[model samples]
Target chain A: MVEIATIVLILVGTFLMFVAGLGITRMPDLFLRMSATTKVSTLGMGAVMLAVVIYFDDLVATFHAIAIILFVFISAPVAAHVIGRAAYFTGVPLWEGTIVDELRGHYDLRTHQLESVPLPELEEHLPDVQVLKVLLPATSPLAGQTLAQINMRRRYDVTVLAIRRGDRMITNPGGDAQIQPADELILIGKSAKLDEVVSILRGLAR
Target chain B: MTPVQGLVVFVAFPLLTIAVILAFVRLVRGPSLPDRVVALDLISTLMIGIIAVYAIATDEPVLLDLAIVLALISFLGTVAFAHYLERRV
Candidate 1:
C-alpha cells in the first residue's frame, strides 16, 4: 500500500512539474506564465515532499517535509504578488485581448491602493493647454456635427485636435470633418474649458 | 529498494531533472523581469522536489533537513529579489 502511494505521489508531482514547465514555455504573455509557474510549480513541490514523507516514514523527515511545504505555501503567493506589481509599475504591457484593467485609472502608486477620490492636484500640474480625449456616444448632440458647424473653439474655448473612429485616426481634421457616433475626440484647451467640453460631449449637459 | 521504488527512482528522477532544466531555460530567456523571477523561483521549488526524491531513494533522513533548510533559504531569496524588483531595497 505504501509503495503504491509513493509511486502515485511521485508520478503526480512529476507530472505537475512537467505541466508547469510546459506552461511557462507555451503561455503567450508574462502574466499567464507567472500564473502558471507560481501556483502549479509550488503544488508540484508539495506533492514531491509528500512522497518523501511517505517513502521514508520517518518522524523527523516528515516534520521537515511538512515544514518545507508550509513555508512554500505561505511565501509563493506573496513573492508572485511583489514580482507582478514590479512588472506592472515598470510598464510591462498586457496582452491585447485583456479587456478590463481595474487598476488603470484607480491606482495610487504612492499609497499602493485604489482611491476613488478625484485628484484636482493632478490637473493643476498640467499645462494651460493640454489635450484630452472623450468618446462621443450615439445619443450625444455633438456626434453628427462637423467641426465648423460645432464651432467648438468659439463656444467651448476648446479645439478638436483629432478624432479616433474605430482603428483610424483623423488628425488636424478639416472644418468639414463630421463627428461620428462612437468617435473618440481628442481636444486641447485650458483644463477648465476641457472639463466643460467633456461634459457637453458626454451629453451630461442640458 | 523494491522493484516499484527502483522504477520510480529511475523514471521520475530524469523527468524531474528535465523539468528543472526547462524552468532554467525560462529563467534565462524570459522576456520580462517578472517572468525571469517567476522562473527562477520555480527552479528552486523544483530543486526542493529533487532533494525530496533523493532522500527517499537513498533512505537518508538527514537530507530531509537539508530540504527544509533549502526551502527557508529559497524563500528568503525570493522575497529579497521581490523587494529588489520593487526598488524598495
Candidate 2:
C-alpha cells in the first residue's frame, strides 16, 4: 500500500516540477514567469517530501520532511517579493499587454521613491499633483542646456517628466539629457507650483 | 536491486533529470535578473524533490535531513541575491 502511494506521489511531484519549468520558459515577462514558477515549484517539492516521509515510515524522517515542507512554504513568497521589488526598481519592463498598472504614476524618478495610496483621512494632507505640457522656446535660457545645469528639482522642488521631441517621447530623461529648442516638457508637481514649473521650463523665471 | 528500488531508480530519477534539464535551459535563456533568479529558485526546489526520492530509493532515511538543509540554504541564497540586486540597481 505504501509502495503504491509512494509511486503515485513521486510521479505527481516530478510532473509538477516539469510543469513549472515549462511555465518559466513559456511566460512572456519577468513578473509573469516568476509568478508561474514560485508556487508550482514549492508545491511539487512539498509533495515529494511528503512521499519520502510516508515511504520511510520512520519518526525522524517524517519530522524532518515536515520541517522542510513547512520551511519551503514559508520562505518562497518572501523571496519572490524581494526579487520583484528589485526588478521593478531596476527598470524591468512590464509586458505590453499588462493592464491596470497601479504603480505607474506612483514612482518618482528623481527621488526613486514609490508612494502608497494614502488613507481617506490622510489624503487631505497630501499635496495636489498636476501635469503640464510646455514647449521649450528656441530663445529660452534653459535651452541648449542639460538637466544637471538647470537644477530645477533642487531650486523649485519640481520633478520634470517626459519630453516630447518631434514625434518621439523621452521618459525618465537622465541628468545629462539636454533641453532642446521646441522640446515639449511634461511637468508633474504640486498644482500650486505649476505656475513656477511653467515659468522655469519656459524660461519665464528670472 | 529490489523491485521498488529499481522502479525509483529507473523511473523517478529520469523524470527528475528531465525536469532539471528543462530548468537549466530556463536558467540559460532567462532574460532579466529576476527571471534567472526564479530559475535558480526552481532548480533548488527540484533538488529537494530529487533528494527526497533518493532517500527512499536507497532506504536511507537519514538523507532526508539534507533536503531540509538544502531548503534552508536555497531560501537564504535567493534572499541574498535579492538584496544584492536591490542595492546594485
Candidate 3:
C-alpha cells in the first residue's frame, strides 16, 4: 500500500518538476519564468515530501518533510524577487508586450511636474521647460569641487534635482556637496538654456 | 501490511528520489541564475521526500528531525541566494 502511494507521489512530483523546467525555458521574461517555476516547483516538491513521509511512517521523517515544504513555500517568492530586482537594476529590457511600467512612470512624474493655469493669464505664465540629465564625466572640471565652489545654480541657472553615485541617490544636495567623478546628475531648468549649462560644465572639465 | 508493500514504500520511494536528483542536475546546468536557484530549491524538496521514505522504511520517527533541518537549511540557502542576486546582501 505504501509502495503504491510512493510511486504515485513520485510520478506527480516528477511531472510538476518537469513543468517547472519547461516554464523556465519557455517563458519570455525573467519575471514570468520566476512566476512559473516558484509556484509549480514548490507545490510539486511539497507533494513529493508528503508522499515520502507517508511511505516512511516515521515521525522524524514526516516532520522533516513538513519542514522542507514550509521552507520552499517561504523562500521561492523571495528568490524570485531578488532575481527580478537584479534584472531591473541591470537594465534588462522588459518584454515588448508589457503594458504598464509603473516604475518608469513614477520616475518621470517625480522629475517633471504638470500644472494647469488659467488661459487668461497664459501669456503671463512661463512655459514649463524639459529637464535634462548629465553625467559627471571622469574628466569633468567640477569633479573635485564642492557645490559652493562651483556655484552651479547661479552660474548656469540650473537646479541639481538629484545626484546618483553608484546605486545610491543623494536628494537635494547642499551647496557644500562635493561633486565626484562618474556621478550622474539630474538637472531641471529652462530647455533653451540646457545646452549652455552643459557646455559650461563640460568646459570646466577641460 | 505485506512485505511487498514494505518493499514498495522503501524501494519505490528511493527510486523517485533518484529521478528528482536527475532533474536537479538539469536545473544546475540551466543557463540563468534564476534557473539555478529554482533547481537548488527542487533538490532541497527532494531531500525531504528521501528523509520521509527512510523514516517509514526503517520505522524510525527520529528521521523527521533530519527532514526538518534539511527544510530549514534549504530555506536559508534560497534566501541567501536571492539576497546575493539582488545585490542587497
Minimal lDDT window, size 10, model 3 chain B: B3-12
Number of the top candidate by TM-score? 2
- Local error of candidate 1 at residue A192 (angstroms): 23
Writing each residue's lDDT as its tens digit, candidate 2 over A29-48 gives 88988887888888888888
Best by DockQ: 2
Task: Name the fnat for model 1.
Answer: 0.69
Q: How badly does each model clash, as a count of residue pairs?
A: 0, 0, 11
Question: What is the lDDT for A60 in model 3?
Answer: 57
Q: Write the per-residue lDDT of candidate 3 for residues A1-206, one digit (tens) a residue.
A: 77777767756765676566566656666667667767876777776777766666556556666666776677667766666665554445566798754443123222332233223453346465545656666877678898889786897777887888888999999998888987777776775566567656666422
How close is every model to the real structure, measured as TM-score? 0.68, 0.69, 0.52
Candidates ranked by lDDT, best first?
2, 1, 3
lDDT of 3 at A138: 80
Give per-residue CA lDDT, model 1, range B1-89, as digits (tens): 77545855787788778878888888888787777878887887888888787777777878877777777887787777767876751
The TM-score ranking, best first, is: 2, 1, 3
Residue pairs in clash, model 1: none
| Model 2 lDDT on a 0 to 1 scale | 0.80
